[model samples]
Target: MATATATARAATMARGSGAADAPALMLSGVGKRYPKFELRDVSFALPRGYIMGFIGPNGAGKSTTIKIIMNMVRKSTGAVKVLGLDHVALETEVKRHVGYLGEEPHFYEEVTPAWLGGFVGKYYPTWDARLYKATLERFGIEQSKRVKTLSKGMKVKLGLALALSHRPELLILDEPTSGLDPVIRHDVLAELMSVIQDERRSVFFSTHITQDVEKVADYVTFINDGRIVISDVKDDVLARWKRVSFPLPLRPEARSASDPAGLEAGVAEARAKVEQAMRGALGRAFAAYKIDGLTFTGITCAFSEDVAREVGHLAGTRPRVLPVSLDDILVAIVRGSEAC
Candidate 1:
C-alpha cells in the first residue's frame, strides 16, 4: 500500500510531460464594449515558450482584454483561443490549460492557504500537490494562516503559487506585481522566470512597470485608448520612439522687434496663411502614413526624432539627441490620449 501511494504521487507531480505542441494563446480582432468604455479592436498572440508583455495606461482596456480572453466577460466581437481551444465554445477545455492571476486577488474569508490550495487543486485535471507545497514553502507562506489575515504581498504570492501548481501550459497575470514590496515582488518574478524555463510553457502579463517588463519580456504590445499603438520586438519599439533636444538659439521676441507697429499684423497673417501649410508639411515629413489610422490628441515639440528633424529644418543643423526611455513613451501616450 505504501509503495502504491508513492507511485501515484510521483505520477501526479510529474513535470514537463504535457504541452508538447500548441500556441499558448491566440487573439484575433477582439473587442468588448461597456456603457462608458469599449475595448477597441485589440489583437495579439503568445506563442509557446515566449513571454508577451501587455502594457497600457490605467484605463486603456488592459483588464477588459484579459477578462475577455479568460472567458470571464463576453466580447462584442473577435475570437480567442487558448491551448488550441476556443475561449468561448470550449471554455471548460481552454480553462484546463490556462492559469490566471487578477490584479487584486481575493480568497475565501476564512480559509487558510493549505486548505485553499487543496480546494482549488480539485478543479484542475493535473494539479500537483507537491508543487503547491514546495511553492508555498519557497514563498514563506504560512499555509495554516487564514486568507483574511495575510498581507497584500502575501496574497499575491499565494495567488501565484496557486496558479503555478496546476502546471498549466499558459499563465495569464494581470498586474501581478502592482502593490507588492520590492523583496516580495522580486521573489515572485524570480519564481515565474524559473517556471517558464520549459520551452513548452508561456506567460502573458499586463503591467505598468516598465522595469519588470524589460526584465522578462521577449515581446511587448503597447495599448492606448483601447487600441494597440505598437506591437513588436521590444528593441524595435524603443529604437523607433526616440527623443531629441537642442538649445533654442534666440527668442522669438528678439526677432519680432525687427518689424514695425504692423509686426503683430504680419505675425497674425503668417499664422493664418501657414496653418494649413504647416499641417501639410508635418503630415508629409513624419511618414504621415503611420499617423493615418491613429487619432492623435496632441503633438508637441517633443525631444524626439520628429522634433529633431524639425529643429534641423529651422536652424539648418542636426539637433542634439536625448535618450528616450519606456517612461518617456508612456508619458507621451498619456499626454496624447485624448486624441486617440
Candidate 2:
C-alpha cells in the first residue's frame, strides 16, 4: 500500500535525476533472528536492469529475506535499500513503483476478479485497465468468477495479472510459479522476460525452481540454513563449481581374522580412509560426496590447476570433472552445509 504524499515525493525525486546509476536493490549484512531459526550476515545486490534469482531450499530464509525487503517483516540488523531509497524510511514511495506477488495471495472469497481489480487498481496511478483486462483474458481467468471458485493455478494467474498491470519499475516475486501448470509457468516466465527488456526495470525472483532461474537470471544468490553461501553472477558461479567422480579402492581382506565381523570392519576401515583422502584433497571447498560400492562422487567449488593436481594425487589418477548445473549446485551447497 503506497501513500499519495510519498508517491508524489518519489515522483519529484525522479524528476531531479541521477537515480539510475544506483542498484535496484542492495542488502548489506542483513540478519534476522527468531527463536529457532536465524538469517545471518546475508548480503547481495541486484543491478538495475538484470534479474537476480534468490534461491535456497525450503526453510532457508528465502521468504524471510523477501518479507524484509517489502517491510512486511522487520530486520534485526543491517540495511536494505530499494531503488536507492531506504526500504523503511521511504516505504510507501518505494512500494509505489514496486510490484509484488506472494506465493499465496489471499483475496476476499466473495469478490470477483473484475471487482478485485478495480479495488486494487486505485493504489497505482499508472494502472492500465486495458492491459489488465487483456492479461486476464490471456491467462484464461474469468473476470466474473468469484475468488473462492478459482483453482490454485488460476489464483496464481490472477495475482500475476494484478502485479503486472501497474507497470512497476521493479518486480519482486516470491514463488510466482508455485502452483502453476507447465504451460502457465512458461507464459509467466515469458512475461517476466518481456518486462526486463525495458532497461529501467528489474526483477528479484525468489523460488526453489532452479530451471526457471537458469533460463533467465543474470545473477544468483543462494542462502542455506539461514545464511548466504553463494552470491555471484550466474556465469561465474557455474564456471567455478564442478562435479568430480572417481573410482573407490577395493575393500581390504581380513587376513589375520576368520570372523565375518572382522572382514566387515576391514572393509569399513578402507572406505573411511578413501573418504578422508578425498576430503583432505578438497578441504573447505568440498561441497558434497557420495560413495557407492565401487565409485565415489564429489562436488567441489575449487576449480583450479592446484585443486586438480591434489585430486589427481589422492585418486592416483585424474578424476572425471564435469560442469555442474544450477540444480546440482544448489543441492550440493545445501547438503554440504548440513554436513557441517
Candidate 3:
C-alpha cells in the first residue's frame, strides 16, 4: 500500500501569508530509476488556489511523479516543493498544512469512522472535531460503523473527510476516484472544486479521466514516457492545440499550370502540402498530420494569429478547424502515428 503521510499537526492551524505567495506545488527535473522503467526529467507547477490535472496514460510515470512529491519514494535527482517549502527539508512543517488522498485509502478493519477520526486527529493539532462531524454528515457516512463495513465509495468519502478536517493549505490526490461509481466520482470532483474556494488552498489532481480534469481543473500538466509533455492553463491548451482539416491537393493527373505549388495530390505530397501550410500558419505549433483522399488534417499545438491571417490566402483550399478535447491532444501526441 503506497500512502502519503502528512507529518504535521499544529496546535493552532493558521494560514501562512508568506506560503500562499509561492506555487502550491513545484517539481524540478525530478527523476527516478528502476530496473527497466525510468521516470525522467519530470517538471511542472500548480499555482496557489487552483486545480492542476496531472494526466497521462498508464505506465506513463504519473504515479511515480506523485510519489516523488510525497517523499514516499526517494528521487534519484531533482527538487520538490509544496506550499513554497522544500518537501524534504521541511517535511513535517509542510505536511502539517498538506492533505493527501490516495487511490485507495487504508484503515484498520476494526476501527469505526469515529475512532479513526479520534486517532488521526491526535496527530494533527489543526484537526477539527466539529468539522469532521459535519463532513461525515454531509457525506452520509455513519461514524459508528466500522470502516471495513463501508462501501468503496463510503470509504473514499471518509478519507476525504479526514483530509479536509484540518483545512490543509494544499491537497495532493492520486487517482482519488479510480474505482468509484459515477455519482461518487461526481461528488469527489465537486468537493475538490469547493475546497479551493478559500483561495488559500490548491489541488494537484492525478487521474487518467480527462473528462474530470476538463470539467474542474484550471491548469493541466501532461506527462508520458517518463517525461513532461505539456503544462499550461487549461483554456490556453485547448485554444492553442487544435484539429485542422482542409481539402486535399489536386491529384498530379488533374493538375493544371495554374495549380498552386506542391498542390499536386498524392499521399506524400498532400501531407507535405498541408504540413507546409499549417507550419506557415502556426510555426512550430504544427505537430503531427494525416491525409486520406480529399481530407487532410493536422494538429497544431499553438493556434496563432497567423492561422487567421493566412486563412484568406487558402480560402478555396482552406481546411476546417476544430477544437480538440484533452484526450484527442493526448492521443495525437502520445501515439499519434500519422505524423508526416
Q: What are the per-residue Cα lDDT tens digits for candidate 2 across 1-340?
A: 4698678667757653225567889999999999999999989999888899999999999999999999999999999988888899988778888889986799899999999889989998778899999999988999998999998888888988899898887899999877678887898888889889988899998989998898989999998898998889999888788888776543445535578788667657657877787556355566777877656787778777787777777666798989999899888876664332
Kindly list the per-residue Cα lDDT of model 1 for residues 38-133, writing each as its tens digit.
888787877788888898899998898999899788899998888656788868766777889998888896999999988999999889999999
* TM-score result, candidate 2: 0.84
Q: Please, what is the TM-score per model?
A: 0.76, 0.84, 0.85
Q: Which parts of model 2 have CA positions greater than 4 angstroms off?
A: 1-12, 15-18, 248-276, 279-281, 337-340
Residue ranges of candidate 3 with Cα displaced over 4 Å: 1-18, 251-284, 308-315, 336-340
lDDT of 3 at 37: 95
Clash tally, candidates in order: 5, 0, 5
What residue pairs clash in candidate 3, if any at all? 8-96, 245-319, 245-320, 246-319, 250-265
The digit string of per-residue lDDT tens for model 3 on 1-340 reads 1222221222122444225577989999999999989998888888898999999998898888888888988999999988878999988878788888876688898999999999999988788999999999999999999888999999999999999998888898989888889999999999999999989789998998899999999999988889888899999999988877777664555454355443443445655655576656343556776666667666777676676446435434555789989998888768843331
| Clash tally for model 1 | 5
Q: Tell how far residue 259 is off in model 3, in angstroms.
A: 20
What value does the lDDT take at residue 207 in candidate 2? 89
lDDT of each: 0.73, 0.84, 0.81
